[model samples]
Every structure is written in structure tokens, then in C-alpha cells.
Target: SIEIGENEESAMCIGVAILDDLSYPIAAISLSAPEQRQSDELIESAGIALMAAGRKISEQMATG
Candidate 1:
């Protein structure tokens, strides 16, 4: 799960869920910017990146 917060007038800080095997978010990634450029596109790209990151992490944990 990812949460976005309007922390500033020109940016939104997003908190990403970093989970463990238990399906709980044990960590997170936060980022902010001066408004989202082409929000739809940015969101899609971010989704892909997060999914890839999550999959890689899961694979590493299962193997190591």
C-alpha cells in the first residue's frame, strides 16, 4: 500500500509500503516533489517500479 500526503504547497510526499513475509509493511519509502508531472504517467511508472522492487526483494528473501 502506498499513501500520499500533501506536505507542501508544491509537492506530495508518498509513503510506500515495504513488507515482510507476514504481509506487513516493515519499512517505507517517502518522496516529494514540486507537483507530480503528468500524474497519471508518473503514477503508472511508479507502480511498475514498486512492483519490480517488491518482487526482487521477495525473491532475495526466499533464496537468502
Candidate 2:
């Protein structure tokens, strides 16, 4: 999500669910950046990266 002025702070946040073996959400991973430092393209890229990282964490958790 993108926040123009949430809590009086300009920031961008993105997250992805980390799922268990049964495909239940066990946790989440997120990234936040100052709005001024992030462009639309950067946010999109970050979202993709977060999703990949979340999947990796979920996989590790399931296997262990």
C-alpha cells in the first residue's frame, strides 16, 4: 500500500503473507520506504521482491 500521509508520515509499505504447509497464513513480510525516496516503479519492484522472499520463508518453514 502507498501512504501519502499516514500518521503524518509520508511512506510506502508493501507486504506478503507467509503461509504454512497447509497454506494457512503464518506470518507476513513487509517493506517500508519514505515516500519521497520511492517511485511507483520502485514500489512495484519492492512488492515483487517481498513476495518472493515471503514464499522462500514459507517454504523453509514448511520443510523444517
Candidate 3:
């Protein structure tokens, strides 16, 4: 889930759940940014980047 900070204007976070071969939880990737510098576009971009990073990590964990 992506959520805003409690202050609403302090931060933004996007998290991807990492899973094992059985699809059980293993770890996670969280990208956070200061809300002041995070516009809607920026947040969306960050989310995309986070997803890409998460994919890379999963691939490494699976094959390496």
C-alpha cells in the first residue's frame, strides 16, 4: 500500500511486498520522500522506480 505520512505534508511512501517461491512474505522495498518535494507526478514516478527496483531485487534473490 502507498500512504502519506501522519502529518500528511511530511512524507510519502510506496512499498512492494517481497515473497518467496511459495509466495510467502520475505522482505519489502520502501521508497519514501519528503512531501514538500513530492508532487503527484513525482510520487507516481517514484512508485514506478520503486517497483522496478523491487523487481530487480526479486530477480537477484531468485537466480543468485
Candidate 4:
């Protein structure tokens, strides 16, 4: 998901959910930046990276 100008500081954010082995939502990971430094392309890139990281974490949790 993406959020822009929706909070008190009006920051921009990208996020993804972390799922457990059963595919249940267990947590989330996000990145936030000031509006001036955030763009659609940046958000898209960050979202992809965050999703990858979330998957890694989920895998680790499932193993341990």
C-alpha cells in the first residue's frame, strides 16, 4: 500500500505484509520518507524491496 499526505506530517510510505507459513498475516514492514524526497518511482522501488525483505523474514521465522 501507499500513503501520501494522509498523516500529521504528511509523509509518504510504502509497506508490505509479512505472512506466516500458513499464509496468515503475521506482521508488516514499511518505509517512510518526507514528501519532498518521495516519488512514485521511489515508492514502487521501495515497495518491491520491502516485499522481498518481508518474504525473507517470513522464511526465517518459519524455519526457526
Each model's C-alpha lDDT?
Answer: 0.61, 0.81, 0.79, 0.84
Model 2, 1-64: lDDT tens digits are 3445564477667868899999999898878778888887888888888888989999999999
Worst 10 residues of 2 by lDDT: 1-10
Query: Which runs of model 2 end up more than 4 angstroms from their true locations?
Result: 1-8
Q: lDDT (0-100) at residue 26 of candidate 3?
A: 92
How many pairs of residues collide in each model? Answer: 0, 0, 0, 0
lDDT top scorer: 4
Kindly provide the TM-score of model 3 when superposed on the true structure, using C-alpha atoms: 0.77
Per-residue lDDT over 1-64 for candidate 1, one digit per residue giving the tens place of the 0 to 100 score: 4334544655655455666776776665555555645385786677678667866775566457
Report the Cα lDDT for residue 41, model 3: 90
Candidate 4: tens digits of C-alpha lDDT, residues 9-47: 768877788888998988998888898887678778888
Of candidate 1, the 10-residue stretch with the lowest lDDT total is 1-10
Which ten residues in a row are the worst by lDDT in model 4?
Answer: 5-14
Q: What local lDDT score does residue 17 receive in model 3, on the 0 to 100 scale?
A: 77
**Candidate 4 residue runs with Cα over 4 Å from true position:** none
Higher-ranked by lDDT: 1 or 2: 2
